[model samples]
Target: MKAYPITTRYIKRGEDFIPIIIDAIRNSGIKLEDGDFIVLSEKMVSTAEGNFVDESKFEPGILAYFCYYWSKYLWGYALGKLLNIKEEKIKNLRKLPKKETLRHKETVIRTVGLRYALKPYAEGGLDLTNVPGTYVSPLPKDPKKWAERLYNEVKKEFGVDVVVMVADTDATYRIFKWYITALPYAINGIISGIGVLGFLLGRLAEIFKVGGFAGCTPLAIAGNKVYKNYSIDQFVRIAFICDRVHNTIKNINEVLEKYNSYVITEEILEKLKHTPVVVVKIKEEYIPNR
Candidate 1:
């Protein structure tokens, strides 16, 4: 299994990710073959898909306020404490409303239990540095769409049997878990629930060290044995190895935790300023055959 880092200027809106990736791999002197899996940064895909929200246009509805005051205090504080966040921030976060709170507990439990949790890895949530006023960039609504487009592009350009996985580099802070949330060639609607389940399961695999395979529960069940020979399978393995990567959550307390140095390259930051797709590719064998 091999992982290659392909860095370049930001990918603008409508930029075809397939060409960028192929060119990058070629430039790196790595030849790709059929069955290879590409692990892309999700922000890049979101950006290309116009999945970002300008903070200047942010509208914190009643829900946002509720999150800010209620959930922040209760669930945010509790979770922060559970995750070992600092005392002061917990206090501050506790003042926030539940709906206004960006982090939700029941949502976490339902979505992926404790497996798919996130702390702000970057400083853009309520930033004055990058944007003029306070603003937060919410998660993308359709990660799978971004993935499918890239997958089709790859197939058409290289004519290889490949899979495209969009991920977040921030996901790797506590663990190297890249967000895998789309499938390109399945029954469209039937694939939806499966995609969500697989994505959450992938997070579970990372937090709990369950498996390195990249798909869902079925993958966990079926690919259990053969996950080591392929890159996607290796994803399941890493996720499995990092088992139970749970963070804390509570709705009864107020807490605020700050991690200031979450690093995004200035290059990538500028790109994200306008769009979110960050592309990178890895070989089928990056994870060894178990």
Candidate 2:
């Protein structure tokens, strides 16, 4: 499989991202072909979809405080080892400042609920990285809509057979043929709403290397893969390819450290590259004459 990353400027909120992305792909000098796949970063779609929240406006309740402590203690201590999460990451979680982060935890509790609020970072896929101060980009309300629009728009521009996927950096684990993820939502194929346990169990297995792959999962899919009835495993492999090619998995913590503050400013963003779109060409041999 061959993958190409289409680079674009930081896609801010209120921008017409779909047209801009298609234009980037057009200018990228790569030709879209039949059976190709287009993978989009969920952050880009969610931001353009206007999902940013002013977290400063939300107050943390008792439940939010509990989640904050839970994240600092449980995930920072025991759960991290069980999942074999990085020791440095666990240390950071342990040292999370209540004064700086409690409000965000409360926001998660109120915005999504206790289920996602229980997890440590990327809580329900809500993140502050690459976003402006006191603002977070929540999960897109309708990922399928984004994927469908991209599918149609790309075809309109390039006139080729292609599948469109809006995807996240989060991984989905396969167990006894059941594909499950910690994500609050997923596309039609992978399972969702499993919450913290999904993350724990999946990462536990991942620690020991359990699945054929564990990288990224599609939030929603459209076009050729839907018509072909591609298995969840097949689709996930495609997402993994796109994710690794771009390899933009810098967590919010890293972003915080780089800027020395919880708030990621526009000056910090200038130092980073945003390639929210990837065009992929898969070899039929990846699935053996499918």
Which digits, one per residue and each the tens of the lDDT, describe model 2 over residues 1-290?
77788898887786768888888988888888878888888888888877888889987788888988999999899888777787988998999889657888888877887898898877888877768888888788888888888888878888886888888877778865678888888877677887887887777666666652355788887887543667788878778888786745366667666666777876667567888888887753434345
Summarize candidate 1's per-residue lDDT along 179-254 as a digit string, tens digits.
Answer: 3432211111112223233434444555566443443211111111222454543454333322222111111231
Please give each candidate's TM-score: 0.47, 0.90
Please give the RMSD to the true structure for each candidate, in Å.
10.2, 3.6
| TM-score for predicted model 1 compared with the true structure | 0.47
Off by over 4 Å in 2: 204-213, 225-227, 247-249, 284-290
> lDDT per model, in order?
0.38, 0.80
Report residue 41 deviation for candidate 2 (angstroms): 0.7
For model 1, the run of ten residues with the poorest summed lDDT: 216-225
Candidate 1: lDDT of 113? 26
